[model samples]
Target: MNIVYWALVFFGTFFFMEFMAWFTHKYIMHGFLWHLHRDHHNKDHDSWFERNDAFFIFYAIVSIVCFYLWSYEDVWFCLPIGLGILAYGIAYFVVHDIFIHQRFKMFRNANNWYARGIRRAHKIHHKHLGKEDGENFGMLIVPFKYFQK
Candidate 1:
């Protein structure tokens, strides 16, 4: 039963990050913190990075804290939680940065229906360069309409 509980915690945290990402992207990033996120929508700078990348640092800290709690504080569940968050972070980076945005130039050939939908939804989200009137704020889970064939 320990393994089952571990899996539950890991997968549960992974899925929950989607909702958390969506919520933060919609309310926080697109809300009062637009100064940090606006560069993502409208790239007025020529650097390889944006202020938006700071958001990833926040989650990285959370995951690292969870790992610390698991190791030093002896919180067993924290291990799975940290791993789940780490996994989700990696997935978000791969899909959003590499595949959709072509940041690293890989996964360019992943043009399946689901991949197309992800790109389409992201394109729509990027269409609005402002904080207001933005849609499709989630990463892994986008609207089903985008998946239409």
Candidate 2:
């Protein structure tokens, strides 16, 4: 039962992060914190890193704190929670940064319907250079219209 509970917690947190990502991207990132996120929509610098990367650092710290609580405070559920957040962060990095933006120079040849759809949705999102009029904010679960041929 403990294993099942932990698994549920892990998977639940994993899925929830998608909503969190969408919310943060739409509200926080595109909202008052547009200064931190503007570089992502419109690249004006030559550096490899953007100010938008600060968002990842914030989530990473949260995951680290969860792991610390699980280890030291004996909060067993924090282990799964931390793992879930970390997993989502990794998926976001791979799908958004590496695959979509080609930041790592890999995953370039993956040209399937899903891949194309993801890129198309993201392209639409990036079409808006400013903080307004943006669409397709979520990373994993894009809209079905983007999946059309």
Candidate 3:
């Protein structure tokens, strides 16, 4: 029963991260913290990294704290939650940074419906360099309109 419970908790956190990513992208990245995220859209930096990378560091710290709690403080559920958040972070890195932004060399040829849709939606979002005009913030749950050929 513990396995099942932990499994459910793990997947629940994984799925919930989509909503969290969207909300954070819409509000925080586009809000007062836009200075941190602005370089991501504006691409003004000479280096490959942007100030926006701090958000990933923030979430990584949170996941690390969850892992610490699960390991040391007897908070068993935190293990699955931490793993789930790590999974989502990896997915976001793969999809958003690697695939769409082509930060790395892999996944460039992923032309499937889902991959294409995600790329399309991200393109639309990046079309607006400014904070206010972007759309399609979520990486996994892109709008259906992007699915069309």
lDDT winner: 2
Instruction: Give the lDDT ranking, best first.
Output: 2, 1, 3
Per-residue lDDT of candidate 1, residues 51-116 (tens digit): 999999999999999999999999999999999999999999999998988889898888789999
Candidate 1 residue spans exceeding 4 A from truth: none
RMSD of each: 0.8, 0.8, 0.9
Estimated TM-score per prediction? 0.98, 0.98, 0.96
Better of 1 and 3 by TM-score: 1
User: Please, what are the lDDT tens digits per residue for candidate 3 over residues 30-139?
Assistant: 99899999999887869988899999998999899999999999999999999999999999999888988889999888889898888878888888989897884578
True-vs-predicted CA distance for residue 134, candidate 2, Å: 0.4
TM-score computed on alpha carbons, candidate 1: 0.98
- Prediction 1 global C-alpha lDDT: 0.94
Estimate every model's Cα lDDT from 0 to 1: 0.94, 0.95, 0.91
- Model 2, 1-149: lDDT tens digits are 99999999999999999999999999999999999999999888999999999999999999999999999999999999999999999999999999999999999999899999999999989999998899845799888888866
